[model samples]
Target: MADPAALSPLAELARRNDPDRFLCALFAPPAQREVLFLLIAFNHELARARQAASNSMTALIRLQWWRDAVEEAATSAAPRRHEVATPLAAALREGRLDAATLQGMIDAREVEMEEDIPSLPALLAYLRGSAGGFAVAAGRTLGAGPEHLAGLQALGAAFGMAALLRGIPAQAMQGRSLLPADLLAERNLTPSDAARDPRQPGTAEVVRQLAGEGQRLLAEGRARAKGLPRAALAAALPARLAARDLARLASTANDPAQPPPPRGLGDRVAVIWGGLVGRG
Candidate 1:
């Protein structure tokens, strides 16, 4: 068992590092939580390392270190200066994780060191690599059923996009825009308008529309994920909550006490276990 205090770094760093991500990690088991944190930390560390040393060669060197660290994580022996590998290696020994998803995550981050996504398709793909990876890692820990796992992936994708959407204003403030150029062009909006702090009035409508679409997808994810076993509860609840939240945000207004849920955790557990196992 991991010391509660030891897991604090994982939890605290996850909270400050990325709240959207930290929420996802919370759905995962503590034993496996470290893997999610290490993946984010590795990406963050690599990004910082690249920025510290200016020039293409320096960035490559740092990325190569990450690559080697990934390779070393596959072996019984550790490599030189492998910070992320420590947790990864422990995960490997305990049969808690593997290398494919983790390596894919590092590779995605390396590609992001210089490139900027300008379209929704590209942004969606990148978001998948970021939060999707975390979802899969957590799913592995929970051993969720396929239906639930699919739902988790979809919900994770939505959460990832939400994070990107939240960062849009910040990016525009820095003179960079991640809004899909096509979306902007089709809507007849300019970067200057989007760059406006809190955005212009019309921007609110656009945000609402995007969130509305996200809510629809989240709805689909939850509907498909309702039949998983009790073991999957830890991960499934968070995804369900996320789906419902995006749905609420997309809607005009909502009652806080009892939000609408097609089939929520409490109800699902009641239907599945209550009738079958609990006679009273």
Candidate 2:
């Protein structure tokens, strides 16, 4: 990791916008750390596209630009000249990254465009493609072999699910909902209903169900992450943070609107300990 006093612009961006992954990247070699930030920056850009653009049409246009950029990076020596795009292209040219994996990250955002998730399975697929895809990319950059990819992906998904749970209240307040429609339906609720009042019994139950799934994924990820190489394990460190958040959420009666306070010191310690021990 770069010195805290002399972070590169990309490193600073990751540190501010993605603290969990940023902490994990600190465990990687210096060269790999820079490349990991490139992926982090790219993912951040893709993540904000929907909010940045004026409409869904504009968002699709922006996402398509990324798709085209990824294609160019994969196929040619020179890709687009944007900050994140240029570095991403370099990673692609160096064989540390691939177009399909990056494309899958973009494809997963299509679900975000929908007003409501259709089912728990659909939400899982979206998280796997977006967050899981990102971890796989980072693991590859950190020199992980094929055998470690699945575990890395699962760890990433666990983090993603936990994150979504934390953000539910904010999303609902904005007239958006990430709760799956079918899950809500089982309790005689709709996404809009949940959005209007996430603390209702039905919505709370859905949150618990989601939390349970996150715990299962976290356990599975940790199990599979056993014996992973040290560098590769860095990419799975977010699972540690996820486990912490899930435990807190469960204790709060799975209330989507009542997130636990941010655990800055605990987060840093958890990532550091997990890194040193090569455990997610």
Worst 10 residues of 1 by lDDT: 271-280
lDDT tens digits, residues 103-183, model 2?
Answer: 999999988887789999999999999999998888888877788788888889988998888988788767878999999
Error of 1 at 20 (Å): 4.9
Q: Give the residue spans of candidate 1 off by over 4 A.
A: 1-8, 19-64, 80-83, 110-116, 145-147, 190-198, 201-206, 234-241, 244-280
**Model 2 misplaced stretches (Cα beyond 4 Å):** 1-4, 252-254
Q: Estimated TM-score per prediction?
A: 0.68, 0.95
Candidate 1: tens digits of C-alpha lDDT, residues 210-264: 5665565466556666665544444444444444445554554432122234434
Model 1 lDDT, residue 40, Cα: 55
